[model samples]
Target chain A: MDIVIVVADAVRASVGPLGAAYALTAIGLNLHYGYTGLLNFGHVAFLMVGAYGTAVTVDQGGPFWLGILVGVIAAILLGLLFGLPTLRLRVDYLAIVTIAGGEVLRTVIRSGDKDSLTGGVFGITQFATTFFGANPFPEGEYGWGRLAFTERQLWVAVVAWSLVALATILLVLLVRSPWGRVLRSIREDEDAARSLGKNVFAYKLQSLVTGGVIAAFAGMIIAIERQSVHPDTYLPAGTFLAYAVLILGGTASRLGPVLGAVVYWFLFEFTDGFLRGAISAGWIPGASSRRPTSARSE
Target chain B: MPADAVFAAEAVTGSRKPDAILVVNGMHRSFGGLAAVDVGHLEVQRGVITALIGPNGAGKTTLFNLLTGFDRPDGGSSTFDGRPVTGLPPHRIARAGMIRTFQLTKALAKMSVLDNMMLAAPHQRGERIVYAPLRSAWRHQERDVEERAGSLLEKFGLADLRDDYAATLSGGQRKLLEMARVLMAEPKMVLLDEPMAGVNPALVESLLHHVRELRDEGLTVLFVEHDMDVVMGISDWVVCMGEGRVISEGRRRSWPPTKR
Candidate 1:
């Protein structure tokens, strides 16, 4: 196997739409954790909500764009549903509710009773054909052999990266403005910001809703990339990865989250490839790639 | 105190006339079983620096919170500009031209010093989310705000540290920054809760000077301070509170002069 091809594949996935999805998700996390000092551990729940919202709506005969719109609205509603009562309490309570909320959402979508709508354990597909058909890229292979994706993947990647860029610009402009400053001040101390005439509770709710909606877009982008939605797709591990991206890209830094995602995915995928390569070469005796010791191979 | 009582008796029903900008009647607040504030009647005359002197737990801060809408009173009526302002939110009270500073100096630590000052500018169009993206709408107003903030910073001798994070400032500097920031609202009345709590001696003198300048500029100032010299030096009148009640209310000189 050509090691360069493996590395190239890692790089492509790192900077492509796959990476940008995490970047967008991390942007919302940055706003929640970085700027507002909120502890929303169930951030991936919005992405789950977004994915199912789009997939189910499309399955029900709605247009792909409408599905995406529904996904966004769903995320916004979820934010409010969690925020309206929780935001008034201490920050840690939001953390507890959000983490538990993520688990609840994942488990509910996997319920056997909802299999007809959610596709249950098998998940949903055929919902992203409309999304890929509008890719605008001419049919051809891009990148090295085995490392390559169709022009369709290239189109999705382009849109994802662009969306990340747009969101970054929007966030930078917001934080520098007076309204953004109020959010930061709220993070510093709510009572202090309140005494300065800011509506502290209102601002907190807005940040939560804004961040959650952005996380929804992350879900949409990810679903479009995979051409499918699985209940496991929005796992708690993904949130942990997004947080790793958030931490890697220092808190409160405007471009940190996206950069963190890019670097993180590159190293992460590269390490997995390296470990597999090493195992196949007999460098590690006990490592298994799940082939179960073939009878002909002795 | 006796003269004030006689004057108060002659003016109206158990209280003086309403010439003051801030007038409170029967304002009371309690925390659990403890009565925190129970001011029967009080007036802060406009265009003067009135010092509210009280020991710890004497209800000065509680009164300030109630008047500024940071806290609600269980029973009372108070007015600013002849408008009832007993139960409005803090922001509404701030918009109505009564700005305040915290006792511990609530400087936004992570923000630049200039940002802390600029954030307090009243009626900022950029603060509205819908109009924030439209740069042209608030650009000129932002410039004006920055200019005002710059001038205030300069007046407080913090012009050089405008770009530095507020967290880097000394305790005394933070106090000055808070004072300068409150001016951004152009409030008609300013309530200062221990404005010089941790300030150095030299800065205290300067702080008193700024307080005088505030009165000179015709803004009503009601400050809660334990510093007797600073109070007597700058305040036109002194109101003394002890155990949630006004023990004495009089001019700076007549209270047995120089207990120090």
Candidate 2:
């Protein structure tokens, strides 16, 4: 196994478009959990809506920008749908509703009934022509061998990371202001904030909408990067992974999610690269790269 | 000690209603067939430290909850500063210049002592989600709020602990912080639910002084207490409740009537 190749792959995964998307999603989660004390267990629902909204709009003869707008609006409405009834009750209620909501949305999108609109279990593809057509990267390989990105990947990477930087800047400013002060106080104790003349419910709903919108943007980035919107991709596992990234980076701090996403993807790709290399060299007994695929297809 | 005698005595003291900061009439509340509070009539005068005293389950806390809009009354009306405030949400009531502290002392434990104080300042423009990301919009007002919070912290002897989380404060310090945080809102009336229930003996003197200073500064105070000495020391008037009714009320000098 070439140690250099494993490190290169790990570095590529950490700074790539996927890491950017994960960072964006976890940033939203930080706003929800770290700042507002909300338990949004099904954050992937926002990503799913974002991805599907853009894809369906584009598929139905809309402009790319319109698709992005539609995705954002869908996520806002979803946030309201999940937040309106539960935010006033208890924090745990939001958790249960969000988790259930994510699964339900995925199942509905992939079900046979929505096949005409959503492409059912197979999902949507080849919808990124507008996004890539506007890519400013030249038609060439962009870096060193195996550590390089094609022009298309570079375009997506630039856009995704820019979005991450913008989101982080916004959160940093917002959390340092008086508004952020109220949020932390609410996160500490709702009744205390209420007694001090703060509208607890309205603030909670606003936090939910803000985080949900950011997650939706993350979904758009993912769909744009992959040139597809797969229903199965927006699973409960995606939300759990975002949470892992959020916690790993440390909550309530700006840029923590970005760092966490990078570290998490580095380890993930490093292990995968190491294992694949080991298997190819026949270094591990009874272990084959082909074995995992066969089991997954079953 | 009959119900009529209680009512007769209440009516006599209730004559000073014209300048009362808070007035309640026939306020009632119950939980699962158990009447928690059923005050027939109560009035707290403006700019005086009044105490509500009772035994366990006597509904002192329930009355405070109802008055501050934490809990709704089954049937009744209340007016604060001559405005109808009945059935308003707690936040609205708080904005209307009535602030309250909890018996358990909700100090926003995870937040810094300074952040807790700054959070209570009313009319913060940056608290609005739209204005939050813009530093220039609320910056001036924020500085002003911080100055006010700083002064309050200094007054409460929490200036050094301003950056420390409320969780780091002792029980007595938390009680002090809660009181100071309440003042940050510039409340016209303050409701304290057992402000000294768990406070240390040394800190109790400071707490009493602060309550006295609040009244002297022209803010009306309504507090619940079980300690007669503390009550007698600070309260200008006292209302005694028993089994969900105000059993007796009297001027401070005449309270705790002596047996012949």
Candidate 3:
């Protein structure tokens, strides 16, 4: 039997793109939850639209840039559609509607009827040519010792992390401005801000659109990195993870989300690695350590 | 001499146009079975200090709310500067040049005193996103706002508290700050509800000076005050309300003045 020790560092390196994707999504969550105080549980719906928009565009022979544009437009449109009716409703209603809306989008895309376009349970594959073609890096593997990545993976990491940094800077500058003060004021007390001549609903809509666009950009990057698309990639679990990252980082602070993203991914990697090692070493009583266990285990 | 003669002469000579700066006609409001206000035909003339006085539960506050667009009336209409203003939102009504202060001094507590004034300024081009970042254009406007706020604060002896949070101010200072914030908007008329309700005597004198100064500066002033001495000393015209309707209307000195 071959013994392959995939420690925390190794696991992190292997799943580097996934962590980056989550980090980007979490940044968007920070904008919604932290700054604006919106409880958006359907953020994953925007992610799904970005992923499917990009995938379907590429599958239909559209250029990668065009796919990215369509994904962004889809995200903005979805944000407006979600925000128009719900933002004016009470906060609790918005939360319920958003969570339900996300679940509906996920189930619809994964349904059997949409299999031809969305690839149903099988998912879509071979959708990365346009993305890889635009890679600025030379075609080769990159990184050191335990953190090696193929040329394509390196490109994805560069794009994903760069987008995260740029978005964070933009958000910091924006939230620091007078406009941002009105937003924070609205978060504190909507009626007070309204009395100050601020259009509260308009500010809420702007926040939703901006945050959704950032999340969709992250989703596009994720689809490009995986070279495929799957409906399961955008689940309630993903939204929950982003929210965890946001809270851990600190809500409404500019660099909190980025810091949160790094800490969350590292912690997740460490816990998963330690659990796997403990289970294999027969330190926990879950599956039998003997060979030829159930086929479901495999 | 009849106080009505003085009021009539002042009304005609000041600006006799039938359209008062603010006119409340047959205004009535009810909260369930309770009638909070039932004012009929109140006119606030331009460039004069008119005081609305009544005992507690006389609907003075409700009348202020209806005039300022904070609450809707169950019946009748309000017109400001000849335009119907009955249904406009409070902010819109404020932007239309009629500003008001609350009895409780509704300052934005979390914001700095200076910020409260800036937010109160009318026609803020910088509120829009495209124009918010324009430093060059807004710098002049921002400076003017700051200067006006600073002058008003200085005039009210609050110059040193510019950077302080409004919530940190004393109750009297909050009342003064609320008055200063309304002045920042350059309103054509001001509706001050209980401007001196809880203010200290020293600040009350300052507030009276400012109210007189507002009239001197050609801004119409209508304030609800229970202090008969203060109302009679500064008010050119007085309208007394009781049980949600006007009981008497006359000049301040001749209306069987009530002692505080």
Candidate 4:
């Protein structure tokens, strides 16, 4: 293969990892939007918090599991902080608050003042050892030919996909249960659920916390795979990507997010790959530099 | 199983002082310059069907909303089963064993009929935690809940539609489903806002029968209705509201100049 083709092939292999993480994050958005009718535009903030929580903890000498736990807790706390004031408000208010929150969180994490602890513009690194240390697979190339993965990549894929599967199953079971029904009922009509003795606010809070934690888990996986945590990774576009995934997949359907994530990543990769190939072939000149802008627009 | 025996027993227990399942004293609610409700005393008796009837904008639903915590009263004390319930949130008041149905029939449109019933049941203590695995014991509890819900749906002749989404049901069926859902909570009293409104004549008969059945089954029923036939046909006692206050109250036979 040509060098460009070889590089594209390498990137294609990484889509699985990226897709797995997105699937998890999308599932969280699915819970908030599809099931509960919550307009949470700050979902990316949960991802950022998760990634930073894990990176910061691991960088500070915490165990990988501890970092994961801290990430989950931070996500939950962030969810509460965001949900408490806004979830009680109308949908429009929540949407505004959440979108603004995502931006604010990104700015704070990237702030020049917090450079020492957060590594400022340089971002955090050397934090993947904790996660990679737990990998049980022996180091070697895995997968068939063009779709091959190194042992490290395969391990990350396994762990990330496993988390997605577990989250999906748990969500399925929960939505089917009495508790899940309450969430759906609240989504259908909050006053009705309240009349039936369901604390609407509490259920909304729980849904936010659960979904946020899931998003955080996805963020942690992404941070681990990249071996870094940067504020730019948690852009508003990430939230929109999650929303797109949620919509593409039937909302309130258990496998919807995962299916959406897969389709989204596949289409995204195909488009990028085709575009890059066209640029290299001179079919689309100056497309390489513009690709990042188009990708960001998406 | 004989309805007469229960009725006779209730009668022989002379003067059968109406057990106040809920007591609203000095309740007041105002909207801007208009006083919506200003009742001095209103007692919802246990185990009897009571009707709160009034013309449009008479504040019948508003009172229900206030007493049930669906809306806050400007001022008043509400006592439910000897517990001071003033100003409690709707869910808390509901969990205290008093559930209500909406005038518009707020059924869970997206959920299956059975799931709607199950959701009405209070959440178990252990279900709140994330790490708590589904144990066999909880499964058994869930099965019992499902069985109970199924039986209630069957009682209301809705068993065949158990798996169907509630939104797919007709207006009458939605009303029936709302009633059935409330039963899942085993609430002491159910405040139904216009259960007979918008129901077909055939379904109205069934709805009235079920309301009577609910009373016979020892659940207090308070409903708001404009249908005089329904109000007189089923209500043990009728309270009429006009301009936001109880204008008149009497036995069904004695309510007169009854032309709204």
Candidate 5:
């Protein structure tokens, strides 16, 4: 493989729609684990609900805006459902319940019985034509060379990044206020915050709901960017990947997840491209010499 | 000054008790089969320094936990400032003007010293998420809180480390910071669990002075300690616990009770 192609792939991965989606996901995780110190290991549950909510809505003949609203509301409800009983118990309990909840939801969505509502294993597609129709960009390519995006991709990237910017601004403002102080205090020690007259349980619930809603929006963006929604896509690995991005950027800081997501995708794609190139060239012994799939597809 | 006069009255009569700021009746807390705190009756007078002293597992800390709403009493009721506060959540008890510090000293290690103090100030409008993102909504109140936190930190000899994380503070400094942080709420009463458990002698003196100052400024203090010197040095009244029961209570002047 050419080094130029590898570099281009990394560049595209860094700033493209995929990076924006992960940035949003990590930002939500930052709110949950970073500032609030909630042990939410099933963060992808929020994403799953967001995507499914929109897909089901649109599949049932609803408009795109209503689907987005339903998705956000669904995420809020999911947050509360997970938070209410376990948040009062212990952080580790929340972690257990959430990861279980995420896996449970994925299994349920992909099960054969839920086919009519969730499309089962096949997933949903073409539900986002309305989303693309709202794209303001004229039909043309945007950006340069391998980094360029078609009109639809450009529209998704623009909207996703704009939402990310808004979320960051909100976080910066919120974290600087007295409210943020209480969250940081709670993160430090719940008993201390409670002794200081903060409703620790209430704050934790609020943080969960807020972060879950953000994750839902991120999920909706992922579906729209791909113009598809699949149950298998909202896996626990995505949550762990989001955690990696959050830690890489710097937890508890507003812009950390965004920067982390960009760098994360750049490295992810660059390494993938390089390794695949090497594998096809038989650089590593005993590795199956396979075709360069991207080369053939392009 | 009134507490001083009350002390004099109590010293002379040995029976003139002031109004109780906190009253617990038949308070009982048990862990599995072991009764941790089983006090029959206890009263902490308003605007005075009181010390709770006991051996290990004597239930002094457990009693503190029950009174401050950190732990529930298996059977009993408590009233603070004439209002029944039984089984109320910890935050409600705190908002009702009763604050507590842990034996371990929760100083919000990751936050700045100033943030730790400012976080304890109650009723900030910005604590509401709706108001949090809008600076104009709570900026003025925030400024006032910052000023108050600043003074409290200065009083605790922590002003120089305002921007530093609380985690960077020494153990004694964390004790001081915890004490100062609780004061930001201007609580009418404070429950301190082992405030001097691991303090240097020099810092212990300053801590005793601060506890005394709290009483002088019209705040009630209930502290648990194993240190007899601290208990005898500052407490206006002393309550001794044995096997989860308050076995003895008296004025500080006659605390040893003249040997039977």
Candidate 6:
């Protein structure tokens, strides 16, 4: 393969659907860790629930909007389940519960016992046709040169970027407002916030639920973009990637996650393609040339 | 004369004041085998600065913690503003018109000074998640809150640093900020834990003045302090505590309690 074409393909995919999904996940993580100081290690659980919720709903012939609604609600419920018992006690409990919840969700979805509803190991597919059919971006290619995308991809891009904008705007407003100030106070010292008449536990639960719902939206978007939902789609590694995105973007800064997702995805796609190309050319034959990212797409 | 040198010549007896806003009866708290607070009866006068002075490990801080609902007492029943507040959560107690400042000055380090003040105001419609997105839903309230916060900051001599981060504030400034921030809640009663700790010599007079002003403004002030100068300079009534017991409750000149 021509090196230019390989690099071009990487560039094209970087800013497309993958970057948008990662942006959503990191934004949610920023709220959990940066603002509220919740040590949620199972961020992927929200995504898994979102994907499965939407997927199962649509597969059962539910409306696409209803599927999205179900996805968001499931995420909120999952957030409560993870937060209620842990938030009142200590930070360590949250970390343990979240990680456990994520693994349990993956196991349950992949198990044969719930094959009919969850589709088990084979997963669910064709849930995105209706989602894409609602798009109104017109029939044309978008983006320039190496980053060009077809009309279908452009539709997802428009919606994804819009959601990104909306989430960021809301975050900017919330963080600067009275509510945001209370959140920062809690992050600084929970006892102080409580002493100031702010219900620390309730505020923490709100933050977790909001973050989880955002992650859920990211999940549904990615699932629809890919037109399928696999049990392995939300592995623990996915949570780490979101953290990478968050760290790349400075914590507690507006547009941090968005900018971080953009830069990180480009580098990720570029390096993955470069390594695969070098291996195919027999340049790095002694080492394994396989990339772990392909397992995600398949 | 220095504000710390000014003395109040008021007099009051044990568990009896002209206007008692807080009454603690049969209150008891213990940590493991050690009792932290064991006051059989105590009454804090309304609209007066009452200082709880004790040496280290006297459970002064523990009493403040238990009264403010920061810690669960083994056994206790207290009333604030004629309502039973014992066993209520800290936030609930605050909402019921009582607020507190920490001993170490929890000033929300990363936030701006103005944001710290705004955090104390309750029932803000803009704080709701859905309404937060709409500027119109809370723009006027936000402005009002900022204005009130700005005035309090000005009163505390921190108006110049409104936009600055709380973490950058010195120990004295943080104490001032924490004190000024509580005023935004419009609390009827203020519980101050070691407010004079880590304060600068220059700012000490101003803090004393503010403590007196709280009483003048019809708000009750109960402060814990180890500084005798502060206790003497401002307290209308002093509740001297030692080893988890009220050694004496007396005024400035009437101190050196004969009961102990």
Per-candidate TM-scores read: 0.91, 0.95, 0.82, 0.90, 0.96, 0.93
Q: Provide the overall lDDT of each model, using Cα atoms, as 2-decimal numbers.
A: 0.85, 0.89, 0.76, 0.81, 0.88, 0.85
Candidate 4 lDDT, tens digit per residue, B1-260? 32222232222111223556778788889999999998877766677677888899999999988988878988879899999988899988999988888889888888889888887767654245352245443677777888999999999999999999998999999999999988898898889999988999999999899999888888888889998888889887677788888776655555562332
lDDT of 4 by residue, A33-127 (tens): 88888989899999999998988888888887888888989998999889999877777888898889889988877885544677777899879
Residues A1-298 of candidate 3 have per-residue lDDT tens digits of 1123345363554357766677778878887877677889899888889988888888878887788888999999989988999997768877888889888888877885544778787777778796778888898767665567778888888878888888887777666556666666666556555555566788888888888999998788777777778887887877888888888888887777777777777776565555556677887887655443321121
Top candidate on lDDT is: 2
Encode model 5's per-residue lDDT on B111-140: one tens digit a residue. Answer: 999888889898999999999998999989
lDDT of model 4, residue B58: 93
Given candidate 3, what's the lDDT at residue B231?
Answer: 88
Q: Per DockQ, what order, best first? A: 5, 2, 6, 1, 4, 3
Candidate 4 stretches greater than 4 Å from native? A1-15, A133-140, A282-298, B1-18, B123-127, B130-135, B257-260
Worst 10 residues of 5 chain A by lDDT: A289-298
Fraction of native contacts (fnat) of each candidate: 0.70, 0.94, 0.23, 0.64, 0.96, 0.83
Question: B1-260, model 2: which lDDT tens digit per residue?
Answer: 11112222333434454367899999999999999998888888787778999899999999888988889999999999889999998999999999999999999888889999999999999999899999999999999999999999999999999999899999999999999999999999999999999888999999999999998798989999998889999987788888898877776776664321
Docking quality band of candidate 2, CAPRI definitions = high
Task: Report the number of the highest-TM-score candidate.
Answer: 5
lDDT (Cα, 0-100) at B116 in candidate 4? 85
Residue-pair clashes per prediction, in order, are 0, 0, 0, 0, 0, 0
Candidate 3's C-alpha runs over 4 A off are A1-23, A39-41, A86-90, A107-112, A116-126, A282-298, B1-6, B9-19, B52-65, B103-106, B133-140, B153-159, B164-167, B196-202, B225-250, B256-260
In candidate 4, the residue pairs with backbone N, CA or C atoms under 3 Å apart (3 or more residues apart, or in different chains) clash, namely: none
* lDDT, residue B201, candidate 3: 95
Separate DockQ for every predicted complex: 0.65, 0.84, 0.31, 0.51, 0.89, 0.71
Quote the chain B TM-score of every prediction.
0.92, 0.93, 0.89, 0.89, 0.94, 0.93
Worst 10 residues of 2 chain B by lDDT: B1-10
Name the runs in model 2 displaced over 4 angstroms: A112-115, A288-291, A294-298, B1-16, B257-260
Candidate 5 chain B weakest ten by summed lDDT: B8-17
